[model samples]
Target: ALSMPHGVRMRRIILPQALAIMLPPWGNLLIELLKGTALVSLISVADLMFQTRQINAATYLSAQAFGTALIIYYILARFLITPMMRWAERLVARRLGRA
Candidate 1:
């Protein structure tokens, strides 16, 4: 894990530095994953976006479906991933002062 024998901990080396280093490539992968989610309708997985398409087919609300899918992705990225990343950074920072 390469934890420091001195005051610099592994998380300091990893979280702010390693995570930032990996995030660009990870963001690209995340974008690709989100794009693939659009294809879920073909498999009948019924995720938010897929259900939106189902709603569109049943009703005439294509906009509603797209809007809901957009919200779902926004919530996942903003509420879920971003906060987790921020927390990880903060936690690592806090621990580094002691480590």
Candidate 2:
């Protein structure tokens, strides 16, 4: 997208809409990120799920971790995804000459 001109029709029209498509996909990405984190053993990447399991093995804070992750996803969808959707709506409107 950087290769395209800023504020020009090609970039602003195309890029923002495309990026907003990613906005909705972030729900899937968040679920995937957490699940991907769970694959530390196979992927060789140490992550939060492994840490949580280790911590639970030691101190057993299962409920807290589960609640925190839920809240995090909710906040992300609210604050992040909603804004992108709004922007996408405006872009679509502008493209239709509604704005």
Candidate 3:
């Protein structure tokens, strides 16, 4: 409350702290969004999942097709999305002085 007694403190202090705390859950939401996009295949949108299904239909190899899809999705989430989220969380934590 030292600076301006009440006004700018919320913007300067509270919002950053709140964002730092909320980022992990927001990351989870991102992962969920990635999974949710797979549903777009139902509408004939040729997403990864859709193409995997197509491969399965053509080759009659559900295990190989879906297994490859699962591995690719895992790699995307593990290597790409997860590290980005971790970097964001660390950046926020550092900014908030909680690192």
Candidate 4:
């Protein structure tokens, strides 16, 4: 058997396992946080939804403004965060020899 330092063992072994277990929920949390940015706009943070609301105010196009923001958020989650999380999960599973 080979001896390994604590950090090395954790990095090479434990983290992968933990990451596999944590990734799904973490991905959900990320998407929720992304959606939560709309709420953040209530505090004057100037996020996407904030700009969407501004567009609505100026153009009086509530449906178009909010719908565009919704589409943007869905695209981000579908194309970006979801894929990234799935890739990470697959990478960790592959490393753990469980893929």
Candidate 5:
């Protein structure tokens, strides 16, 4: 048997494997949650969708306003969220000696 404390075993053995298995699905869930934030506009929260609606009402430009909002969401998920998730997954993999 290995001579290690419980915390050391967990940190060195369990967590990396768990994180590697979990990270991909977790990343997808995060992006989905970000998109779901637009629904908060229905409750009168001043979110991106709400701002888009305001722009649409003022200029009567549905495509432009909503399109811009779509682009913003895409940019956030693609540039920020996805990369961060990939980095975390790689870090976990490296820690597990699988990278």
Candidate 6:
């Protein structure tokens, strides 16, 4: 309010602050989205988990099949989504002058 008039304060101050505060939760939501994608297999979609289930059924190798799925999911989250989320958080921090 002191830095700007009421009308411009929302655009200049509130929105950026809101976005910066939302970054961490937004990253968590992304990770949840990745986990939720596994549910697509319940509807007969041929996602990674679905294929792993099929392989386990065919080969009767539950440990191998499920282990591979777990490893793949870990790699996807650790190498891809996690870094992207961290980068987004850092970018928000920098934009908000908190970095």
Best by lDDT: 5
TM-scores of all predicted structures: 0.54, 0.47, 0.82, 0.79, 0.80, 0.79
lDDT for each residue of candidate 5 in 1-99, tens digit (9 for 90 to 100): 189899998987887788899999999998999898874455576799889999999999999999999998899899988999999999888877898
TM-score of model 4 relative to the true fold? 0.79
lDDT of 3 at 16: 88
lDDT of each residue in 29-95, candidate 4, tens digit only = 9899988866446557668877988899999999999999899889988998899999988887888
lDDT of 2 by residue, 1-99 (tens): 566566686666776566555655665665566455553344575665656667777877888876665675567566765676677667766775667
How far residue 2's Cα lies from its native spot in candidate 4, in Å, is: 11
- Candidate 2 wrongly placed segments (more than 4 Å): 1-50
Give the whole-model CA lDDT for all candidates, comma-separated: 0.65, 0.63, 0.83, 0.85, 0.88, 0.83
lDDT of predicted model 4: 0.85
lDDT of 6 by residue, 6-49 (tens): 87999888988998889888878877877777744555766987
Q: What is the C-alpha RMSD of each candidate to the true structure, in Å?
A: 6.2, 7.7, 3.7, 4.1, 4.0, 3.6
Off by over 4 Å in 4: 1-8, 38-46
- Where does candidate 5 stray beyond 4 Å? 1-8, 38-46
Indicate the residue-level lDDT of 92 in model 1.
54
Give the winner by TM-score: 3
- Identify the runs in model 6 with alpha carbons over 4 angstroms from their true place: 2-7, 39-46
63 Cα displacement, candidate 3 (Å): 0.4
Can you give the lDDT of residue 70 in candidate 5?
Answer: 97
Stronger candidate by TM-score (2 vs 5): 5
